[model samples]
Target: MNGGDPPFAQRIAQVSESHTTRIFTRAQQMRARGRDIISLAVGEPDFDTPAPILHATARALADGRTRYGPVAGEPGLRERLAAGFEGFSADRILVTNGAKQALFSLFQVLCDSGDEVILPRPCWVSFTEQIQLAGARPVLVDTDAGFQLDPDRIAKAVTPRTRAILINSPNNPTGAVYGADALAAVAAIAAEQRVWLIADEAYHVFTYGDRPHVPVLGLSPAPDGVITVRSFSKQFNMTGFRIGYVAAAPSVIQALTRLQSHTTGNVCTFAQYGALAALEMDPALIDRRRVALRRRRDLALGLARALFTCAGAQGAFYIFADVSAHLRAGQSSADLALRLLDAAGVAVVPGEAFHGPGHIRISYGCDSATLGRAFARIKEGIKEGL
Candidate 1:
């Protein structure tokens, strides 16, 4: 070892860089270089935060709401979150910096070395990485054609060392929403196996078609060991604010709260007030965003289906398209993504990062004009074999 080098944790060295963030960084560099890059890589809405929420934050600032507060978040926000969770009590909710932090804390508190956490493939890239950070191995089960979680596959993956299963409905990369029947089946397997079921419902507010977002806690004969994670980032376009919450059994909530207290303390005071106002304000604001997202999703899916093989994008703001048809015989997803960026100036994330190689995730959160330009560039690139 070099004398000048400080020793770092073995775990930190082993952790992989986030694929999504890496691509985002490249896009930023391209923009700096004056490239006409139409970035469809990151999952973020292009719209400004709702006006009412903005106004509320201003009011909070005027009222001197800036100070260190409860480690579990402001009481008013927790109360509103508790009410939102059907019949759950306020004590069961613990707010954190974001759903990402809440998830990291949950894994830290629950997972131990050599334990296994089951995650469905084509998942959010962070899922596997976070479990690894907690010293737990991620057991990935491949989904069916539309990226729907197959309960039978989950059952097969479970072993005596399995500690928990992480499920993300209205999922990140695939935008696949598990049906009620599928969720119920998963709950049954978790109960029979006696493993924790952690559900990520970040995109609960954005859905298309007639199906509603079903929280696993609401399942009949509810799975006794269920934990739900919710976020204000997607719902209220509060991504920069980094505010989210976890709802679970009081025991699990306490463990997560303690872990967060030592790690991030509480989220920013002003952000907490902003989220509270989002919940208390007119529901119509959220409804409008939902409708707009649905329109964008439909358009993107239409384009994807005409150009590539894609499905399971009935929710969220992303479309995971199978680009194997476009890839040359020996080419990989990373190769194809770079080529697309260079030749077409369109930025997309390779599905390889999400354990779904031969595909790429495209976000439709941008305005119609930007999406149109991106698709056109992609179309030309594919035609020219670029």
Candidate 2:
């Protein structure tokens, strides 16, 4: 075995690099080299972890609560999670390292070689990759102008091999929050087609409209094959803590728990306590953050529309603007992103990585001043063709 040789699994070799992560890495590298970069690339909150949660974590650390726990999660945390979902119980929950890991484990357990999972385009970058990593095919369905999942498109994409339909509400990249009617249509399709409906509700707590965030599980005559994945990372500003969970049928939860036991046994003990604390703490703090994010969303959308001719944001902390209006002949989103970084010191993820070319995702999770500066640079960069 030569050191320079690629020793390996063919499956691993076939995997492609994650576009968002690559862009984020490049931005970090440029910043390290002393570039004055204002990054709107990553989909994370720019706020500090809420004070109560921080204090709770500190207390847990001082209480000598650090030890290996259940593979599913700390028993009490799992109970709390189950209770959080209105009609679910502990049997329906399986907590894992992060929502990412929990989702990976779910895909591993549910999908097999040649299985098909229907994905909505302009999706989170990881969805397709995760399906491929599970030896499954991702069947992408394109959304409308607002990026809402079209039931007709999803229905057309279904086939014998189609085992599941994965949806992200308050979606990443595009902030289209699926409404009740659209969700009902999807649930109907999944039920009729006998496919799993996996809803990623990581942004569940961050809705800015008249309609509340509706989970698939909450639908009446609930699709028997629905699974809801939730994360504390975004809601509680606990991304570093790496704690998330899934709620589904008892059998599905059991399978995921078994898979977790053989793989990463459990999330960090203290993190579980921290998450529990988040659930028990003042719900008002989360509401406050929601309002703040809504304000950011509105500001970013206004700036995005002023700069580009395409769609503006509706929900989530991101505004996915079509940069095609500004594209030069043969220029890719990568080129535009690099030019923006070099000329205006602002960083954003190109849409090609999200399977939609000629666009970019701008995160508005930072403070108002930082967001103002970032958008001003973006405006200048676009006008100057940088």
Candidate 3:
């Protein structure tokens, strides 16, 4: 153990540090230093967890429900969650630590060394790392200029080693919602190629205008080999609860449950009850959140368009703006994001991490007033960059 201890494994050292995390960490540091930093870097709702859910968790703990529960999740919560989709049952749902864990474990089960997962960029930051961790290759294919999925591009990226195709609607970072036609094309491609199709619909409840989040599982005939991953984080402000579930064939659930039995097992026992309470929440409350997010989206988009070229933000509470026009002298998106943090006290995620350089992802989950001020600072910051 000499020489500063043995070197860590190559796998651990070779992984890319998440750029979003870098920005988030820096913002936290600035905040600790008493800086008035406005962080739009983290993908979390600013809203409070609904009161009913909090009370439910409290009640569960009081009832001696703190002990470890089923690895496949509490049957009550699973049954409730499954009720939304026809044919889904508690036996077919395996709740995990988070949608993140569900995704990670799914990849581990689905891919092996050199197996390829077709990913459309700019994607969520974790997809590549998760695929890599599973000993698989993340074959990234860039989206169209408007950030929409081009099925032809996906078709071209597929190969014999392809294990799955991962898609996110109301996607993280870019906030682009893939259209039904495009998803259907992908569904056909997955079935024809005999590969898995994973749909991360974590932001399904936040779609705007005519752009609705379509689950691949709900597609007509619902192509085989499809796995749908969802989380309570965004919709219910349950990020801290860490409850997310996956819906697939019963066989997939069995496999995940087996893996879960060895891994973290069930999510917090009481947290599952909180999630059940969340399901019982009035839909009106959700509508209000969506309304608020839609307004914030507009405010952020208006400010972004004034400074840089950006596509229509259809879903998710983010604006993926192209900052290349304002970038000067070899400044990558990360550099510009850093400059925004330092110069304007505003924090945003660099699009480079999402495989879309010269762009930035601005989360509008902040309050409207905060968003207004942040956007003002962003305008000034971009001006300074020019």
Each prediction's Cα lDDT score? 0.88, 0.85, 0.89
Model 2's lDDT to the true fold?
0.85
Q: Residue 83 in candidate 2 has what lDDT? A: 82
Candidate 3: which stretches are off by over 4 Å?
A: 220-222
Ordered list by TM-score, greatest first:
3, 1, 2
Summarize candidate 1's per-residue lDDT along 1-386 as a digit string, tens digits: 57888889998887889888888899889889999898999889998998878888888888998888898889988888989777677898999889999899889998999899999988998888899899999999998997888999999999999999989999889989888998888998888888999999999878887467787877735544999999999888899999989998889988987888888888898888889989987898778888898888888888888889998888898999999999898998878998988899999999988999999999999988888889999999998989
Instruction: For residues 1-386, write the lDDT of model 3, one tens digit per residue.
Output: 56788778877775899998889999999999999999988898699999999999999999999898989999999999889878777887889888999999999888889999999999999999989888889999988988888889999999999999999998888889889989889988888888999999999999888588888776735444889899999999999999999988888898888998999977899999999999998999999999988888888888778888998489988788998877878779888898899989999998889998999999889888998899899887766652
Residue 351 in model 1: lDDT: 92
TM-score of each: 0.97, 0.97, 0.98
